[model samples]
Target: MEVAQFIIQILNGLSYGLLLFLLAAGLSLIFGLMGIINLAHGSYYMLGAYLGLTIMKTSANFILALVGAATLVALLGLIMERVFFRGLYKQELDQVLLTFGFIYIFMDLAKYLWGGTPRSLPTPPLLEGSLEIFGAAFPVYRLALIVSGLAVALLLRLFLEKTRTGMIIRAGVDDKEMVTALAINIKLYFSIIFALGAFLAAFGGVMGGPVIGAYPGLDFEILVLALAVVVVGGLGTLRGAFWGSILVGFIDTFSKALFPSFSMLTIYIAMALILILKPSGLLGRMELS
Candidate 1:
């Protein structure tokens, strides 16, 4: 492979990794704060892709599709939290079973509503172009995706590190009972976090639509990847999600280039090795109780 090709590959991996970071970051936050292993989390992404596509087709507005899809997803998440997940807190088996059931339900809905056909969200006209990189014409859209992911990361860090709500959230993660004792509406925060997770998943999906497309079984594939990110990046830290996504993204991308047939196998092997070396993950802290 030439240097240009390798550089392009690196950019590809970085773009993909950043998507995974935002996607997995939501899962990590939810689990860290709420102890919920939401098996159906990927459905948020799937639905977002399909819905965003629909919105774009109807309105021809990319920004609308993104915000609209994410908002709808967040609303659904709130409903799930209030209607189902609220009662299942700390009940691991129940949570798993409930969320797993929703996955099937979502799959069926996607099929019925969108059909089995795969679809791709077209790149916005404003972003339709390429940039020369190492003499390679890398898609400008991809670079935009990378920048968007990084910007969101920065915003999230600020939200979690600087804001009063963020401080409350962190304190809640440390000790919910104590936070509750302080008369803070921790329950409302839980709902907010759950909705926020769903929103992030949806945002990732719409942004990734042009690259990965909307299709059946994509949810499960994303779920596996997100789970892998969490496992490798540790349970809940944003730092862990960032580094883990980059590492996993690079390994997965390069392995696919070299051995397409055994790409997933390579990822698993890398994950196993990392686990053996550091069980909790590179920058992961003690799991929140």
Candidate 2:
């Protein structure tokens, strides 16, 4: 490949990786703090995309659609958590089964409303076009995604570090009982965190709708990748998610680009090698699993 082509792939990889980070961040937080395996997490992603499309068509405004979709999905997540997840937290198998059911329900619902065909979202007018760098042009939207994902990551790190409530959350992740003993409302804190994760996942879906067309099976496909990210990054680790997303993103992009003959096999090889050398992942702490 030429230098420009290589740079383009790197940009593409970084953009894709950032989107994965958004989904994986939520998955990690939910798994780490609540100890829940949410098989239906990707459903929220698909939901966000459909919602974005609907909202955009109705309002004729992309920004509003994005905001409205994210808000609606976050609300849906809150409902799911309150009605289903709260009870299922202590029951891993039950949570898995329930969420697994949700995946199919969401897929069927998407098909019924949006049809079985794929749909696309256009980049908003303001963010359309390319930026020149090292004599190569790159999509402005992809660059925006990188910036937004990085900003969110920074905001999250600050939230978990600078504020008292954030400190409580971090403490909870490390030792729930100790944090609870300090007179904190563990339930409330967890609920907020869960909602936050949902927002992240849904937001990612909305932003990625343009690049990765919204379709029926997108949820399962992204879910598998997100699961791998969580496994490779370590459950309940934010920093781990960042590193793991970048690593997996690059591996995924390059494998598909360079090793078209064995693209799928290469990902498995990478995963296996990582697991063999570092079972806990690049930045994850050892878990009981």
Winning model by lDDT: 1
TM-score of 2: 0.95
| Tens digit per residue, CA lDDT, model 1, 66-163 | 99999999999999989997787668679778989999999999999999989999999999999999899999999998999999899989999999
For candidate 2, the C-alpha RMSD (Å) to the true structure equals 1.6
lDDT of each: 0.89, 0.84
Candidate 2 residue runs with Cα over 4 Å from true position: none
TM-score of 1: 0.96
Model 2, range 26-110, lDDT digits (tens) per residue? 8887777777777878888888888888888888798888788888888877888789877865777787788898898889988
Which candidate leads the pack in TM-score? 1
> Could you tell me which residue pairs clash in candidate 2?
none
